[model samples]
Target chain A: MCELMAMSANVPTDICFSFSGLMQRGGNTGPHKDGWGITFYEGKGCRSFKDPLPSAHSPIAQLVTDYPIKSETVICHIRQANSGNVSLVNTHPFIRPMWGKNWTYAHNGQLADFQSRLATKYHLPIGETDSEHAFCWILDQLLQRFDGDEPNSEDLFHYVIGLCKQINELGVFNLLLTDGDFLLVYCTNNLHWLTRRAPFGKASLIDAEMVVNFDQETTENDIVTVVATQPLTDDETWHKMQKGEGLLFCKGQLIYQSS
Target chain B: MCELMAMSANVPTDICFSFSGLMQRGGNTGPHKDGWGITFYEGKGCRSFKDPLPSAHSPIAQLVTDYPIKSETVICHIRQANSGNVSLVNTHPFIRPMWGKNWTYAHNGQLADFQSRLATKYHLPIGETDSEHAFCWILDQLLQRFDGDEPNSEDLFHYVIGLCKQINELGVFNLLLTDGDFLLVYCTNNLHWLTRRAPFGKASLIDAEMVVNFDQETTENDIVTVVATQPLTDDETWHKMQKGEGLLFCKGQLIYQSS
Candidate 1:
């Protein structure tokens, strides 16, 4: 399995710190070095960068480490590549458009059965991987349901969740997605969350040599939450998810929950 | 003050169903008629359309209703301008590129005490709104901290959250951001989330004349999450966030917690 990290906060925030720490794990501390990708939302749009190289050594990851792009929502992934070739298309954190909005996604698990069946529907795969094919198939199914018109987010979410359940029955399906307004997450393998508000404290990452004293940088009213496949930091308490748990986050808080 | 809809799902899904219902609220069911914007994340990029008109009347929004582009993540906003003049730059969702990645953001609240004290160390305002200024400042701080290099996601997230907490103390700050990798959300006013997993059901919007039966389009393993400032559907249960809450979502679930 790969690794995933996401954060929603009560104020504008950046994922650089945690990303840097996580990058170390992409290859240095972990084996998810096949590829990596990340997406950040500014307002109603998104910026994404991906590399087939391990996040630990990629120049792009380094740049992300130094440049802190602050936003209310963020998604990132490091891949082990069980079902996809190591190419740009095989990278995690895929992007697409639906309902006139930009949508971004990343996944951290394998879907062995997603190959042949996925190709039967949706657009062709731009890369040789089940991930992209699955993504395309999902979109294709969505288009089919809506008759080529964008469905509402509510409808789309339910449909997609249902699809995810079906996929999970075949294999692991941990995923992260966003539409520049909300963050949707599902975990069939590994995931965790840690929210910080008043009384923030210092945190240290387990995989990297870094420490952040949130109390020094935050106020009593600030609330920040982080989600990841594995805890990025050792000092912070991360909440583990049940195998089939998922959640939707907006404005730094959990709005929808499911198990 | 405005109606917003977003979805993150484990599968690619179109948002026509929710948009149809939300469109009625754009002018018929809600007051956020100043403008509307939506973005979808496809593979490794994004597609977005914006109109400086009410979603109910905008041709672009109508086109969105008619065209289905499926994506894993989606963000849509119907605006009621509180800051910045009514222009494209003043739209609810703003997009930018940082550290070689696309960033998307949207806001729903007003900043009261930010006009005068905006002369800070980093990013400056590209638009007249405090939101833009804050975005610029956050970028500046990130650049400064990393000396123009992209920091890791964890570091960036922590740094941005620090700045967000500081500025939010000065005024209202309810915002969304993404880099196509993670969804980071901060709330100072209002936000909600709804997530569905296996055994999905039918749902209808509370503010519009639309309904969707997810059973027809969904699989059994899908995990989908939706977040919004207000509930878009009337028939489905929506989760509300308490004041001063923030979170980070990845992989279709909440990974971080903040209160």
Candidate 2:
């Protein structure tokens, strides 16, 4: 199993405060130490940093925590390597171009017989990881359905939800996916989310001894939503998603949710 | 115009010495201050770091210079934007997945009437840059020529050379492209290459005050070749490539060249 974290914000915002807590769990407080990766989206372009080293002590991970890279959408993963070998190729938060937009995906749970369960066509897995194979499978499905042109947002959201449910049937398939504009999160087992808006307050980390007052760091109109496999803060209230549920967020606000 | 840098090595080697000099040219030594990016290949997986900020002052660039990430192949670019805006989407060293391999590209010159010259079908440019349009055009052509399976390396090399010649006709199109295993360099006007094998000696950077003794850093069996728009070092004797010429290098050895 792995740990996944994603963020969507109305304005370009940094995930340093939440990432600090997650970084501690990569090796210091938890066992997810195989590797780690993160992607930040600014407009149509997205940049990713991945290391085949423990996030808790990786120099690049430390740089990420110290540097505040502002982005509208962000995705991160810390791997424990359940299926694939521990290498740079197996690091999570995989990205591929689809419909002229770079789509990023990360998984937090393991799937049983993933290769046989998912049949990919247009997009193929570059890395020999079950998670990457599943991501490519999902992209291939979307490419088949939509072709080059994008479908309506609502229709695409429902289509993706159906795909998520089918993958959830295979096994524990918690997912975080985004294409720089919209962030779609699907929960089969463990996932939690929190939204901070105008009435933001101070928050303390659950894994690390760090605290940040949102009032001092954010403007009143700013809206930021963070999703993770587990709650990173102890003070902030996090809503746990039910199993087999899917949610879509755009510009930090929830746009769709599966009942 | 931008500055392009690429490396092909028989073994995993760090480009910290050359990258240090290139970092200075991003804003301090030269005028390529718009943005910068670099991709390092580790097996089938490749990780890239890009910033819209100037490389000279970018903290991410500082981390790249400080951290010695070893890779068999690397493609880097520092942009002095002419055809696109100074944003992350338009940053150089664009990447796309084709034939289940991550193909990375960086260009150093502008193309006139690129949109008309290149007609893309399968892949499209997400960023509004002539460079990216040209990259997608190249990929689309490859996809059309070959299906999912990879073609013969020699045939693919010749095909790519022909494509480079066609793009070079539009304008200056000095380029560096790679598919993790092979590095391809195309020169229209300014490009230089240097290969260091056994009996390695000291090399000094031209843009920065840095000296490295390959004798201490590399093994006797190591073969490393570096390609750049200009000679990155003052001490090493770099070979200047001829106009409308394309070279294919695999494992630091020249495998094919266009007459």
Candidate 3:
């Protein structure tokens, strides 16, 4: 399996420290290599980058460590070949537009016979991975249910959950999604999270030779949350998730849940 | 609730079309104007941008729209205040490092009476949101369990999942995490994904006034996956998750699962 990383902060914070460590795993510390990608949100805008090279040896990855771009929400991935070939087209983290919003998605699991069941009138896959094919299938179902119209939140949530159940039956379906308003995350295997509040302190990186003094970089009112496939530091404690749990994140905190 | 947007491709692919549509929801079509964030990963490097301003009116957002940065994995979030005050520090995505890799996180739910529960050895928070507190708490636990060492994959996975369950008891704990190798997602409420592969076609945005012709932008071997809080298009279907399900994504496809 590959790895995943995410962040939610109370202020515009840079991910240089954490990202540097993750880069090492692409081919150095761990064995993800295949490819890597990241996305940053700035105000109403977004800045993203991707490369087909192993993050551990990629020049692009170095730039990220040197830059200090800040954001409130972010998602990233490094690939380890599974169903698809080790090519640039088979990277993680995908994006689309739904209900007048740009919905982003990333997956880490296999769906048995996904292509056979996928059907969409408005969306189709551009790659060969079952992960992407599954995305198209879900979009097809949404269109069928809503009839090209935006449904209310309650209805939309129910519909998406129902669809998730069906897809899960085909295979694993852990996922993360957003449309610029709410963050929806679901786990079917392994995931972790860490939230910080007032009284920030010093923290060191577990992957690379780096460290950060939150006391110096943040204020007393800042609140930030970091999520990852594995704990990113040797000195930090990480929270894991149970199988078949879904929750939503809004405004730097969790708000809703279903299980 | 907030909104999230992500894309995982076989090769580096631009999220311009989907992002354009998602931008509308930051303040134009939705009320997630509290803040916005986006992270793009290229190889081992990442480029991210975020603002505490509404994405719809931010000049930075406009610039993002004009620039076509591409990546294999991307994560973005738009904010809507619920627990913490609307400040730049209270944005969606947060970052940290561990096990020689970078980790990014974003949440979409509110935890009741959530606060940092670290054992005083992990990094603390600078804000008051439960999200940040949770981040620190998780880090603290990981550090404690591993004895200041990065555990192996299986050990890390088991330990982290245990932590997630602990936090879930506090309230909702939906999350997205990445270390640039894989995308690990957990759902305790709402999360969805759609995968795309060969035989692609045009996809219209449900929130914005734009569309993308996948056939023109991708190859037959390309594989991509998208995760979202809600489907971003009006005519596409999105797969939803069960209350307790988690998945891992690697190489633009699913790899691990728990339900």
Evaluated with TM-score, which candidate comes out highest?
A: 2
Clashes of each: 152, 0, 223
Predicted structure 1: lDDT: 0.73
What are the per-residue Cα lDDT tens digits for candidate 1 across A1-259? 7888988776778887899889997789888898888877767555566667899988667867886677778888898878856756577777655554557777777677677656533344455666666676776677678864666656666777887787787678887888777788888979899888888889998887889999888778877888998888888788888887878777777777777
lDDT of 3: 0.72
TM-score of 3: 0.51
TM-score of each: 0.51, 0.99, 0.51
lDDT of 1 at A141: 78
The residue-by-residue lDDT of candidate 2 on B217-246, one tens digit each, is 999999999998899998889999999888
In candidate 2, what are the lDDT values of residues A81-197, reduced to their tens digit?
988899998898888888889899999887878888898888888888888888988888888888877987788889998998888877889999998999999998899999999
Per-candidate TM-score, first chain only?
0.92, 0.98, 0.91
What lDDT is obtained when candidate 2 is compared to the true structure? 0.92
Q: Reference contacts recovered by each candidate, as fractions?
A: 0.03, 0.89, 0.08
What lDDT score goes with residue A80 in model 3? 82
Error of 2 at A148 (Å): 2.0
Candidate 3 lDDT by residue in tens digits, A94-178 = 6544543445667777788777776544455655688767776777687777864767655666677677777788877777665
Where does candidate 1 stray beyond 4 Å? A119-123, A147-156, B1-259
